[model samples]
Target: MELPEPDTASDDAMDSFLDKFQSQPYRGGFHKDQWEEEFEKIPLFMKKAPSEIDPKKNPDLACLQSIIFDEERSPEEQARTYKGEGNDYFKEKDYKKAVISYTEGLKKKCADPDLNAVLYTNRAAAQYYLGNFRSALNDVTAARKLKPCHLKAIVRGALCHLELRNYVEAVNWCDEGLQIDATEKKLLEMRAKADKLKRTEQRDIRKAKSKEKKEQNQNEAVLQAIKVYFEDEDRAELYQVSPKSTLLQVLQHPRYSVKALTPAFLVCVGSSAFCRNYFRGRKVHQVK
Candidate 1:
């Protein structure tokens, strides 16, 4: 859903309120005759809608700003009031409101850059709770960009990446964030989980490969053992290999010792001598 454009009516209304105070000695645009009437009106208007607040109607901002910003209120009182508002919303888990309260309370106007980072981080967390992942990610990114070392924003950004199922990105973010807050337990856990998942996947592939290799090796070993046990290992090797004059040369070339025999000689002796004699003897005696 699209949000409505910001209403300018409040600011426009404020302009009219300020015009009446231009030549006034005090704010609230109240003259001597109007003071009592305006005093009675403030309490009634304070109970009305917040967005409807107009200095012209009730003059709370003017009065409050005067007391809060003026040298009138003790510094401690001013601080207590600001902290009270911020703490109220913070305890209520209204982080967006708390952030605004805290921001407005910063007495040092030059401190806004740091304050903005805190506000952005708080609102990002609230957005995350509201299931606005993209908005949360944007706020965190902005906060980090403003203050690159913001540990909260970095951790939150990594968590958002995890929620989004961008595991690689999540791991990368956590890795970078860990540099800033090395003791961040949550980030460590997230990176550990991602690492475990990656290792598990690799283990599965390795297991599959090992199973295939085992099957292949078993089949090869069985074939070799079968040839040796039944088919006369010698004769099978002789048939598989060509026996040329090189065989006779290697076998009778007495210059070479039998232990030094080539693989061709071993095959010829193992297959031919035993198997050929047995077969020929069996055939000759079988004449009928």
Candidate 2:
């Protein structure tokens, strides 16, 4: 039975229909226009994405600086405000933010050395929490330079050095702090820790040196034994003993055998005798 040439036209038309049907845009999802309308409701300040906010030129930060640094506001008051903000952040464990606030307070450049010292010390605390030990040390140094007797800065400096594995520097800083307040418990504790670590490090070094020396001495002793065996004339005479001599005959020889020698010397001389017998085709047991 011959099928009619097959309805090519109808087949092409059906495929076109299926393709267009599937290709139509889905109407079930929210449209771009609806999303745009919702987005417009957000406040302008809140609408600025994090990527749009420049760290160095943030508008909120600029506004904060303007308020604090106003000519009408006392410098001391401004510094205190910034310090308080930093303290708040520090209490929240936001150390990087605390550092920023403390730094802003310092930028005010207040005339009071005590206030500046406090600011520097506070920033050092933040830096320490952030694991910037070297930076913390630097801040503490600045604080100390401004007020030599600042106990907090001195203690913080010691702690920073301890974190950096600078035991000697930590001890020195602790000593400096103790000079100002002899009964400071924190300084005493830090000094003790540094001293203990230093002692442990020194003990390890001494042990390593002792082990190395012992090994070197053993090696030298072995070399010396070999040298003496080769150089001693009395031992060298054993080489002239006849290969045909029995084991007991060698030992019984009047001039060859000796007594009261050290174990190491005896071993060396015995090894030489064994080698001489081995080379002359005498069994080792035959020369006992």
Candidate 3:
């Protein structure tokens, strides 16, 4: 049986219907084109393209096999690749980038103790340069845990504490480093620097405290002088005396008796000219 001749009108209608269905707004399926546009807007560093990050597809079997087979494609090699990249950034003083590279190397999870220690220490160095002292200290501490005698880690940890103004911790870390390699020039130098800084800081604190105490003592002395002068009926009358008022003029005031003036009091009043001046300038004090 021969099929009926195709109807051009119905064929065009069917084509139009299929075209509308195909072009209908996607409800939730992955839209690669739209995703690409949005993905492009993200920073290059933040964008992990699917092809580059598919764990199932790109399993690190080569790295694992190298560890098992002792081949060059080892985890160490992979970790070192990122570590070397970090070192290059560090040398160029690109500390932020160095931190990123070091972090990526650490994510490789290499089992080599020395490599892990170096990775952590190098990251700490980058963090130090970036003024992330707390983060640097944390990384250095991790390095120390891995290899307690790691000289670079010890030095960096001490410096991190120093930057944080934790002089005591800085001194402690420096001393620990010194215990390992007493002759190591950098350790020795850092220890001495930390010690000197700690001493200087302590001295400054003492000086500040001493100055505060001296000010307090001086204030107490002034208050004592004021209290003594005001409480004495004989000297209380002198408080009203003007700076230019003479001793003889003050003595002649009705509030004081001529007989009440002691020889020492008269001598003090005559020498200073004014009670306030006498109280302020004289170390010896007497009131009657």
| Candidate with the greatest TM-score versus the true structure | 2
- Give a tens-digit lDDT track for model 2, residues 1-288: 997798999999999988987998666555676876445433353553242334364655456546756878877888888899899889888899889989988988999999999999999999998899999999999998999999999999999999988888889999999999999999999999999998888899899999999999998777654422111235443233333555556556554444565222223333477655633643221222
lDDT score for residue 199 of model 2:
86
TM-score-better candidate, 1 vs 2: 2
For model 2, which pairs clash? none
How far does residue 183 in candidate 2 sit from its true spot (Å)? 1.5
Ranking of all predicted structures according to TM-score, beginning with the best and ending with the worst: 2, 3, 1
Total backbone clashes of candidate 2, pairs 3 or more residues apart or in separate chains:
0
Candidate 1 Cα lDDT to native: 0.63
Tell me the tens digit of each residue's lDDT in model 1 across 1-288.
999887799988888778866756564467788776665566555433243346777566667656655656654455455556666676777766665565555453334465656656766776777677777798889888779989898888888887776667778888988998889998899998866765776788899999999999998766543321112233332222222334444444323334344332222233445646644533111101
Q: Write the per-residue lDDT of candidate 3 for residues 1-288, one digit (tens) a residue.
A: 999998999999999988988999757554676876554434352343232334354345334334533435667887888898789788888899889988988887889989999999999998988888999999999998999999899999988988898988988998898888888787677778878898999999999999999999998766444322222344443333343556666566455454435622332233334755655644433332
Q: How many backbone clashes does candidate 3 have?
A: 0
Worst 10 residues of 1 by lDDT: 279-288
TM-score of model 2 vs. true structure: 0.54
